[model samples]
Target: MEEKKFDINTLIGFVLMGAIMFWWIYSTQPTPEEIEAEKNKTEQVKEDTTVTNPTTSEIILQAGDSVTLAKAQTELGSFAYSTTLPSAKDSETILENDLLKLVISNKGGQIKEALIKKYVTYDSLPLYMIKDNNASFNINFGTTDNRTLNTKDLFFEPSLTKKGETQILSMKLKVSNNQFLEYQYEIKPNEYMVDFNIRSQGLSNVFNSSQQINLDWNLEGFRHEKSIRYENQQTELYYEKDDENIDYLSIGGEDDAEENDVNWIAYKQHFFSSILISEQAFDNIKLKSKTLVEDEEVDTTFTKAFYLKAPLALQGGELNYNMNWYIGPNDYQILKKYDRNIKEITNLGWGIFGFINRAVFIPVFNFLKGFIGNYGIIIILLTIVVRIIMSPLVYKSYLSSAKMKVLKPEMDEIAKKYPKKEDAMKRQQETMALQSKAGVSPLSGCIPALIQAPVFFALFRFFPSNIDLRQKGFLWADDLSAYDSVFKLPFKIPFYGDHISLFPILASIAIFFYMKMTQSQQMNMQQPTQEGMPDMQKMMKMMMYLSPIMMLVFFNMYASGLSLYYFVSNLLTITIMLVIKNFILDEDKIHAKIQENKKKPKKESKFRQRLNDAMKQAQEQQAQQQKRKK
Candidate 1:
């Protein structure tokens, strides 16, 4: 106040206080219409939110509430219900026998879960063929009220009855006091088959008799094996129609098929199946199957999903449909007992290979399993038995190789004599003559090996589908039916997979050594090479290495039992080769025998004589071509 002059800070504070006071006064005032509009906007959002999210009970009630009894009576005439509607509270009833257990829900009056009593999944949990909203069985029809109705949304009253060893569960959907739609399921002790029958009582007026009822059945196949990829590769939908051959969908991808007069439809998994068989054939059926990608959150427990829609014919005013459901292991003997050709789902193989597995391998394996508890020892015994049975053929093959080895020096002489490319035919003829004189057939080695191919292929089909090997463990393998991983990789390797399987690696190593031993024995044999022909030794060497690598890659994802069989088989073969080389076969004796045969008068068979004639003709033609060129 000395000079009555204000500083810059004091002037700024006065201006800021005046501006704040003016803003507060302006915000406190509002019009009546603006407040009403803001309240209306907030109410609108609350109404929209309520409409979007509804409770489960509300959804269930909506289905019934959408059509009142008065409206139904007006549209349906005398068929309308005057009683109270069924409750929406879902309930489940279980019907279990010694072999299987089924949970039936009131909502659809269908099977909500199916569990096999004797088997468990790969994770040691109870095996569920259908569960967790993955299966749906519904009947779709037009009601008297002209509304398309799906039986899945309606609740049914369930009743249980028992007679001796059979248990019957009946679900009834009442249309009136005495009229109803009924589902009767009968389960017997120690049986995997369930008898299912649908009957209608005095409901002819309520249903549209002119139209056929559509039965929609769907099931998602849960994973029961250790490898989801393998299980998916084996899962498929199979059906039989018109008492003819059984048909199936592609096992790899999504596919659908239309069929007529279907007798049964089977949802086949890797080791088990669920089949629906009709007493009277369905008129037409449409089936579809889809492979589910592996996802830990959603699909890790399932392999594929299947859908089937079949048409059932209704007669007079009532519908009576009879069917059976088989939910059990895919055992060949057990399925064959049904006599519906359902055993074809086992997929042992095709043609003679399948026949061998069915006729020979299955019986032998089962017989061995009866006495031997350990699968590993049984496999060893099986290998020994097979080798013993095939000893004569193996001996013949080895004898052929021995003859080639003993004659290597003379073969080299023949090769040296025909060094030029034009002399190939002459050298071949001379070699054939020498082989004939020595009583050795050039094809002897390959023919015996070829004869054993059926057994090999038969065993290839045997191990993977053998249910007994499913969870059996041996040595380092926790499950013989699945690949035995010694080490798991963080990343997948293109064709090799994401794990190192010990059995396949051991099998590959055995094969490599076996090839090495055989290759060394045949190294001295000389092959005549033409100008454009590839080097035989190099090709053979490449095959020796490439074959084992291929075995390692291909069998890495195959069943451990199969790889174990190969490993043991190869080791036995190598052992036999060593035994033959050391104690059974002597080079001196073989050479002496060959020399003795050569000294004798050589008798040419018709085949050898014909081959010699052909060689001469070829040589003559080559000579003529050379002259023409000159």
Candidate 2:
């Protein structure tokens, strides 16, 4: 019935359908000239977009079927000639010298691996300073088509040549037969240094001449030591800039920026280093380092990763730079010969302590090493020489201790006269006067002890960084540079470690006896029981026990050479103290000297007068308070 009525809504719908059909037919039909014009316009649009916003691998995949390599190349213009797409197969070129073997890959034209021929890892495996695709050297620039290009991703053609005792590897990425970017590496026999030179010709047509190029270098340092944690703690990135003092990143991990011109950058491991030295310093460098996770599977294989980005200014439509890569042991002599302050990579303490190590300990150690074949014997000789040099200070400290012991009876009488806590100030005043009369300065003992502190710390730094100590065998120790494990436990301990190191145990025992003897000597001295003073006797007792335990725990995972040094040094100290007590000094004679000195009239020094005045002021204040109370 509705169809028969021919409703107004049905009439409007019929009219709309007919109009759409007419429009579709009109839009579909075109003349030959129109079709050709449309095709050219589409191609032009594509070229414009590709040139302005060049697609990377990620962008190309996102474009799906809408983009093709053929279409992309057509839009590349002059850049298409220089572009070298990476292939699935990568080939390696080997450059070997007497001391080093370097593997360069065609994929990146950079060092893929570096092997130190004379050394091996702590586990006796071939030593690899750089390997496992862990190192990358890249040059990044913008192509003429606005494509972001990295030399690391492009394939290169490699050629080898020999000149006398030198081997040269040339890796070239060709734009044309006459135009290319080349990386030339030269290695000489019996040398750890490799000369690296980069040169480019006619690349100004492919790359923007106005823009600067960025060089990015990354290295993942593998662990060559027995202890991964120790190696990580010792590994650091060192760089020299502007001929100023050498600077370094924190050993574990850190990020830093260098605003000045940098001469060299070194990735220093525990026993070795990979250094890059540039003839022309690099400006505006950003460096970062990250410690590797301690995985049971890979802990012995790697220590940390480092990244450095530097900028280079291109000149006259060409890029030319020369650098040297020093891949070798962290030997002081070898690195010092570079004259680049590269030797500072060794952790030889800081300030005066470092000075002592460099000036005294290193020289002495080397001298001893020349004469002695056994490292253990050398350490003993070193301890003896150090103690002999410090004997005068040791004697002064002993004399001061003896004088204090002799004054114990006189000090006790003062304590008895001022029995109450309120009389502490008076007792201290009388004790000072008694000491002044006896000509015994209370600081004399501590001053000599403090003077020996730098030497102790100097030796602390020397042992671990000594490459000669690495893999050296001592009694019950396989590697003097690493912890000597007497027994390995199945389970790990928290503060103590998973193994018992014999050297640390022996060192702790020696330290305990040395402390006990020193504490016994200190106990003979009368300590004033002032109201606010810490109990010196109690503190001494605690230190006597606590220090040995700390040494045992802390030195367990330290270098065996260090533990051996401490053990020998402490034993020598105990022997020296015993000899001093038994033969060198007589207590009866010290007492006689104290009595003789007390009988003589003593003039008060300015410091003593000021101390007395201060004491009197305090007493006057106390008297005022008492009067007020009355």
Candidate 3:
């Protein structure tokens, strides 16, 4: 209360904040109307896709056998499987195609390579490679280079099945050191999951007969490169004991870092992999090892068992392996059911926060998603709920502010009484007394806001991984899935660069309005300390303007969704504050309460007494030092 200092530095900081906000608003003007139009366009895109049959392919599948192929590029690395089933009315060929880079099919059924293709987007680029445009998968059945290898006979041999009863389709491969190998496959119709069995008969015999039998199986024309990742997590290379062993793992090329990459597992790049589980333990499984053949004409055999393929050779002892192959998307609900830890593939938040994400945030978000199909709407609803939950604490903060306002007049009087004192102890004591009488703490408002910082940070982390919000439209934003820009600049600016986004502008405006409202309240009630001292009210007014400006400048490049939430929250807070200030808090009641407290002669706490004593001792010490110098 010794003359409240009006610091020039505070005013300068505020001006800078305002400048920043103005720059941002000028750059990113709002396109609220455009966002609505984009929403309409998104619906039309879905409708157009349904009407167009652009993916209609003419490949046919017979009743007893099945075939799978990829229709993208020369390499059919993706998968397209077809099987005909006899329904009561008619025969239908069930074809399931879905592509996800890193996932196990156990949760959402068998993952075919075809379904994992994801599209990339950029600010100014045309989408090339539309889905299902590969013309190369059309196979001439009897031709060797037909590319689309038929697994029908091997999996669904008509002679082995009954005429009337439905046969569950399957395929198995047995390789021996014998000159010729007989292969068979069974076919099942209208089924999503498939199991595999592969045996390398007489493996020890083949090992003894030949120097070494190199088993190299390639899922050619399956149109997909494998991705290594845990369930419901970011895609990263699988870690192994030896880092150098990465050379053996031939997934996709490093040059194509934008998409598929070399996973950590030694041999998991080419679809799913499993070694022939013989009673004998094998030493190692290598990837992309070059086996230079002196004679190029040697026959290479291909065997199919469900969605898997393996090369067979002769051996001394039979080496057999069994495995359930899962090739599917990283759908959390679907994968959690398999108990294979398959849900770890989604890019949910990581670390202790990740634990919170999985345990608390994800469940809450999923629940919200169930009710609101539109992700943008869901985020808005979620924000409202969180705000409501925190309302009580927020109200307390307002109460603290109101009480401080009531004590300002008395605080000013005490400051005037201590006009000539270099001893700050008396001034501090008077200020504390005023605060105690008013039942207000200086830090109460700041503490509540600080407590909510973690919640804000957690929400920031949660939104990006929320794929459900991708391509969703909110007010002035085109794709809540990506950045929403109203205009792109012809030239780049120094700190701000170019590219204007409307959401940030709207957010800045809202922030400014809210700050102005709050600042007005704080300023109008502010009282000056000494006669010559500058009013603290004016300095606070400058600060109120500055902070919102800083926010506007900084948040322009941030996600529209984040800015939207903040803008809405601030607006609501301002509304609530206004209501409380006008209808609930009255000056007469506050003054009466203060007078009542003063008449009662409230007892000081030990901490307050200690602080007052310390200040008094410091003031006396300084006075003694001054007297000695005189």
TM per candidate:
0.84, 0.84, 0.51
Q: Which ten residues in a row have the lowest lDDT in candidate 3?
A: 223-232
Per-residue lDDT tens digits for candidate 2, residues 1-630, read: 445665899989999999999999999999999999999999999876777565433332332334544443554434333333342126799999879999998777889989999999887999998788889999987776666777776657788999998999988877776777899999999888889988888887877765668999999888888977677788889898876578888774555665569988998888999899888889988888877755532355578888899987777878888988899999987777876778888879899999999999989989998978999889889999998888888788888889998898888999999988768778888989999999897788889889999998888899988999999998889999999999988888776778899998999999899888888777765466577778898898899999889989988888999998999899988888888878999989888898899999999989889989999999889878878999
Better candidate number, 2 or 3, judged by lDDT: 2
lDDT of 1: 0.83
Q: What is the per-residue lDDT of model 3 for residues 307-417, given as tens digits with 9 covering 90 to 100?
A: 112233333444343333343333445445643333444435455655656776678779998877776677777777777767776777777677777777777778778
Q: lDDT per prediction?
A: 0.83, 0.83, 0.45
- Using TM-score, rank the candidates from best to worst: 1, 2, 3
Instruction: Write model 1 residue lDDT over 161-193, tens digit each, in one string.
Output: 999989999988777768878899999998888
Model 1 residue pairs with clashes: none
